[model samples]
Target: MVGILLQPQSSPFPLLFLAAVSPPLLPALGVFSLIIILMAVTIGDRLIVRGMNRFRVWLTPWFKSQPSPWLELSWSLLQWGLRLGLWLLGVIGVLLLPASNPLQRWLLLTFTPVVNRLTSLLVTPLFTLGKATITLTSLFTLIVVSLALLLLSRWLRNWIKQRVLTRLGLDRGNQEAIAGVIGYLFTALGIIIVLQTIGIDLSSLAVLAGVLGIGLGFAFQQLASNFISGLTLLVEQPIKVGDFIEVDGLLGTVEKISIRSTVLRTNDNLCVIVPNNRFLERNVVNWSYANPQSRIHLPIGVAFGSDTVLVTEALLAAARQDARVLSHPAPSVWFKRFGDSAYEFELLVWIDEPKDFEPIKSSLNFLVEQELSYRGIEIPFPQRELRVRHTEELRLLFNQPTSPAPTSPQRPSQPPIPPPQAVQSSFSAPGQFAQDQTLRVLLRKVAYFANCSDAELRVLIERGYQKFFRSGQVIFRANQPGDTFYIILSGSVEVLSEGQWSPNQAETPPLAVSIDPKATFIQVENQVLATLSKGDFFGEISLLTGAPRSATVRAVEDTILFVVDRNALQKLLQEYQELAERIAIELAQRQQVLRELGLLNQEDESNPADKTPLQRIRQRLQTLFSLSDRPGWPGHA
Candidate 1:
């Protein structure tokens, strides 16, 4: 047996002596030694793997750019490479043992045939591509290179999109559209280039590609249409990300535009995926298209006996009180068909921002109800009167003789009408109209002065003077230093802000009107922000802060306004400290609201009680009007 084990090798060394002693023991001992070596290899590989993981963890931060797909790929490759190297070293160490060693001899005898078989297996040709015969090795190399190139291309694409296009000032839609197109082109070109590099001629695959394309076209016709439609939307800008739109009664804002579909975020926070072709084929209402301004209609009703003129005035006042309503297109009241119990009227108003229509309309409804109630107008419910003739009653009446006409009770006498002179005096004076009394009534209706006492109102009536303005006349210009405040007594005036007039107001000079209303006085440059009807007041901020007029005021129709100089307003504020606090609160609230609506330009959104509002008012009064310490003025030092 010893001779038999020694005869297989030329120089037995360690194995020869062991086999010489006991041949049967050599096999078991060789197997035990192989198991021990395998255990060591596994243990070493695990330790090495742990070390590689630690190294990778340390190396990760160097490539810290966001969305780093390449970094991830590189780390994976590093781990795999380290594992492969460690395994290769283990195999080489096993192979490097002395020829006489039992472990080395056992390994050679066990794995040499397997290695030879594997090498031969790898060399065998799997298939041919064009003129190139692909083996396992070449196929693996091709796959690796292709994956690397694809990863590099993806990294390049993202880098260009975020760093390059963003810096070029392209809008989000255009940038995404361009990036998508480039990514598609790069993928297609990369595949073609890679195939050619692998010795596959592109000309040979045209037949197969055409057949596949035709098959895919038939299968994905709608998909192709949607993709094309998405491109069209991006190019035409009919709807964009962040645009509010309504399609098939689904109201939502566009969140994302992809090749085959668009995502919409509804007001309820639900995400809906809509096909791009749906937008192209169906009617889509884009509220933000061209401009954000849109017209809204609010339907109202009043008792039939209510004064129509008074109802119209009340409706206009309700609309004018809301800041969202645009003044350029002054709200109009249209009398619809008289209903059974009430007269229906529709108030048409234009809003600068389309999104505000719902809330503004709701607020207007509330205001209309309050105004109608205050003016003694009733909103009647639907009424119907029915007269029924019962069959039994008719039969009884015909059968029996009627007896109700025998005796009737006497009715009370009606009151006699008063004389014409007494009636005329009761209604109005012949020549002397109570205009002053009317002015006082109008002042009482004004919201800003609503809290004033009757005596305060009397003082205002004594100090105030009425000014009449014709239609299309200018009342005040923007940015002009103002010391007077005015309250509308009748008719309507437009409050035009300076910056929002026209898109090209600065580039294209305003058209020279034949007769400029305020053009004679430094020219009126403004956009109509709101309309103020009777009981609406302006220049109150000027009274409080003594700042320049922030907006221009123009008469929308023949109007009358009672003008009060700065002195009177100062006295009113001085006498009533609570009124000043209320004014501050209202002004701060309005500023906050305007900031939310993007109308006011305030830097910080701190707490409302911060000294900003009051300090600003006092600073403006001191700086603009140069108010010194005085006896009556409380704002003075």
Candidate 2:
């Protein structure tokens, strides 16, 4: 074996030269090279492993924090890159070793080749498999990850804006835009990083870039316009969320503004999608842009004879009752037109929020109706009068009465006339007969007393008293006992009350006082005036309860009254419970009006002061029925 090793082989250089290069020098050089290579491989492997470990650690938090599939895919790609690099280097090192050297050959053959082949085989399959796996992983990740990041960044930005920036007194418009920009920037960064990790080299995509650019230009023209419009909106702030706007004739609340569109929810609960371009181009009435305060104009018409000052005051009072209306600016009513049937007026009131305009308008309408009705101001409808020209022929046709021929209608019997003495007697005792006769005539005209027999009305008339008042007389006081109820008879009269009187007596009467042409002297505190001119009755409430009068009555002019005694009223009520109930309802309505006018201050018996009505009812039920501490009835605590 020694001789065989010693035998010389043919070479280009001398044997001694070969010996000098091959022996100690070659061995030392190889050893040094091997040491360097091993050290490099060891360090490279350690780096790869360390990076993989670190990435795994990083991914753990990312996975837990985000639960996004994209991050997981990125982590997997990093691991693959490190493993691939380490495997390639190991294969190269093994292939470079000399096969003739036993130690080197054995080391290469023992572990190097196996590891190299295993890694080499794994490289292609793993890469292909990894690519497929990551493709699916990233696809799913794109949806979930994008959504998650978008929500997170949006929430964080909004939090910062509302909590930090807004608290710092920053302009809300600028702060919102800034927050949106920051959130979008974060989303873009995340997307770029994710795509890069997945091996999508944006720099190498020249053809794709051109295609994308053209496609974007064609497909996203509106999108780009909306983006620009959004920026314009941020800068201009023509409209904002919570603003009441009328855009393209659609009135609604500006609920949300996005890049491409603005969402408006109308009063009808319909959502309207308005394009940004349209918003910029069309006339947009942003009632709250420059000023959040808006003016509400309510137009009303009252009968011509209605007291203008009283009507104005009632309108103002109604407006004042609504808390939304501003007081300092004050409500104003303008007599706009003298309509044919009614006096037209416009009420202008200012409110703080434009959104409240509709509700305020509705409330004002209700109040106007109630107040006007209370004041006896007639809201008249459109009236048209026809003047008929009667020709001689038409007059003859109306006046002519046909006489029946002898066959069926023979001759009508002549009616006998009363004697001169009877006529004289009837005329001579006019004063004594006037009371009963007037009441009997009135009972026939009054719808409420329509069912009463002539006998009953005659009784009522005899028992009832009568009085007369000059213009401007006190009829009753509020909160006084509900005594005599009144029916108006002859001359016009006014209904007045203490609350209606001005606090400063010189200002004006407060009560809704009206000069009713059909009305006569009104009933005062406890008396019913029966002989009001033609067809009026009073003291009906007294007949029911013998209670004091709830309202005062005054004569606007010289007025006549028929007073019904308390005993007479009670007797009538005792005979008819239904009549009593109807009177009670009427009294309740009157009381409600008095309460609204600040004249009546009676405490509601249904509602206790200590607890809400609902609460009181709940407590009563709990105590009486012994209910457990479970869910109580709705609206109860």
Candidate 3:
């Protein structure tokens, strides 16, 4: 090792005194002074550290707001510099003392060797730049400075991209494009600057250019394609950061577009990295490309004998019932074709947002089914008849009487229209249905049908269907079909009032009603509108107003419900038109009560001055029953 050499200085100890003493005290004194200096330096470092900790607390918020690692390093350097300055001042003060003083002589003796070693140049100079010689130390310093400059340049680039370009109102694609270009340009410039600092001539790199070109041509073909594709995407703006897209059967939202890869976030919250070249080469469907509106067609089929006009009207009503379906465009029902056993139809409707595509389509399909069922229009399946010629072998096989063939179960047929009957007596508790007697009694208990005679009640019983639900069971979700009205017979249910429900929002797990029906309890996430016990009913508003469900209803216990759907009510209302006035009054009173209880919003509040509740109810009933051609009626063909 090349050790630093110091120039000889005068020793403070006298040589004759050392000879007299035999054992020298100067070495021991030097050792003691080193201990004292070390102790002072350690104490000074601790004090400086404590002060810096306090200062950091004060500056934490400022640093956090504009967080950068370099800022923290700068602060640390300042602290150490202050500590070094304090040590230097103390040493100078000791040195300034009188030459004859013992403390000055000791300080000089203890620190002189350390000072000389640090100042010594251990390596020979390599070259000269004007007056300064380029040595190993200078070269190392240059490398460190170059690295620091590169880091600073990167930090600046990111700061400009995030803080300045973001606020310029450019599209996200453009921002990323500009930022990527800047990064490449900065990286190249930094390399050139570093080479220049090292005294390397830029012109000397020309010899390797041909070799590099050949390497890139053979090894980086795909990389080049992706880079060019990325530039094309940025320029064309075919898809933005928030655009919902489907490319090569992968569906997701565009999150980021880099030079080689594009990042996508799926609906299930998974990140996908796709090559940029694939987007340019494959077919990509941007759902929200230029307009957010999109049309949905739900194909349906009904029995051949069903009324065409009625099917069209019912389809339109189902579309109109949904709040998400756009009305200005006007939903349409087209008669598509006639199959062997059924008449094929399609319900065409438009929605405002492409994101609502799946949910709206599902909702429309459900409504259409309910509407068709309510109107007694049968959705038929493909059917075929088998013809067998009675040959001798077939007849012999049939006659040999093996076990009978198992037959496929058939779907239950629509109930026959019932003849009016006497009102049946109220039955006992649930889980026991004696004929349709219990259901008929439950129907009579409902407020809407309290005035119905035995004949009207029998008509309802014929048309209604009975369902049993266990506790904590969700009968239907909020904002689903409201085409069916339910009346509790023996048990109870809870009405959970919620804002307009969006399926994409966080959902509660399905209630665990699989165990003991009476033991299960559901914690309502939304506000509890009301609780309904025996003889109480819900879904009247949806049935009467033809609106989506206003609230979710879950069974509180093992409950039996007599459901009266739209068609049954429409049929009964046509026969007993006088019941309309009473229905309106009852519904209006319930509306007022619901509003007072905060279950209903201001939009659904009654305006008796504009139109009497009775008149409005009559108009709605007429539209529902196809008894009017009013201009504003949605049921009009």
Off by over 4 Å in 2: 1-152, 169-175, 192-216, 268-272, 397-637
**Which structure is stronger by lDDT: 1 or 3?**
1
Error in Å for residue 115 of model 2: 17
Q: Which candidate number has the best lDDT?
A: 1
Q: Which whole-number lDDT from 0 to 100 does residue 412 have in model 2?
A: 81
lDDT of 3 by residue, 1-637 (tens): 0111111122222342234222434343444554465467557756776777786675454221344455556555556567667666545443343432564565468878886775565345777654446677767766566656655555565666678888998766567667656766786788677767666566655655676878887799999899888877766878877678889988888887766888888877798999999998999988878786778888888998986766765687678778898865667667899888799888888887766678898898898888776666778889998888878889898789688778978868987755434222243322332333344456666787878776677556545555789988989878786788987867999988754333333564343223333433443346677999877778877787676776789898999886778887877877766666567667667756545434455653355345544455556667766553444333343
Give the C-alpha lDDT of model 3: 0.67
- RMSD each, Å: 21.8, 27.9, 18.5
Where in model 3 is the C-alpha error above 4 Å? 1-171, 178-201, 328-330, 391-637
Query: How do the residues 1-637 of candidate 1 rate in per-residue lDDT, one tens digit apiece?
Result: 3223212223222342334324544454445554565566567656755675676455444222343455456546655566556556655554454432665666578889999999988888898756777788778777777676765565565667678998999866566667656766787788778778777778768776888889999899999999899888877779877678999999888877767899888878888999999999999999978677788989998998876756766677677778788765556777897998899999888887665567888999998987776666788988899876698987787899666776668889989999977785686323433334344566666556667665566555544555789999988887787888888888999887664233333454353344333432334354568998877778866665555777888898999887877666665655654555555556556675445434345554465754465555444444444445343234544
Q: Which candidate is the best by TM-score?
A: 1
**What's the CA error at residue 104 for candidate 2, in Å?**
28
Candidate 3: count of backbone clashes, pairs at least 3 residues apart or interchain = 0
Candidate order by lDDT, decreasing, is 1, 3, 2
Of the two candidates 1 and 2, the one with more favorable TM-score, higher being better, is 1
Candidate 1 residue runs with Cα over 4 Å from true position: 1-161, 320-332, 351-361, 387-486, 489-637
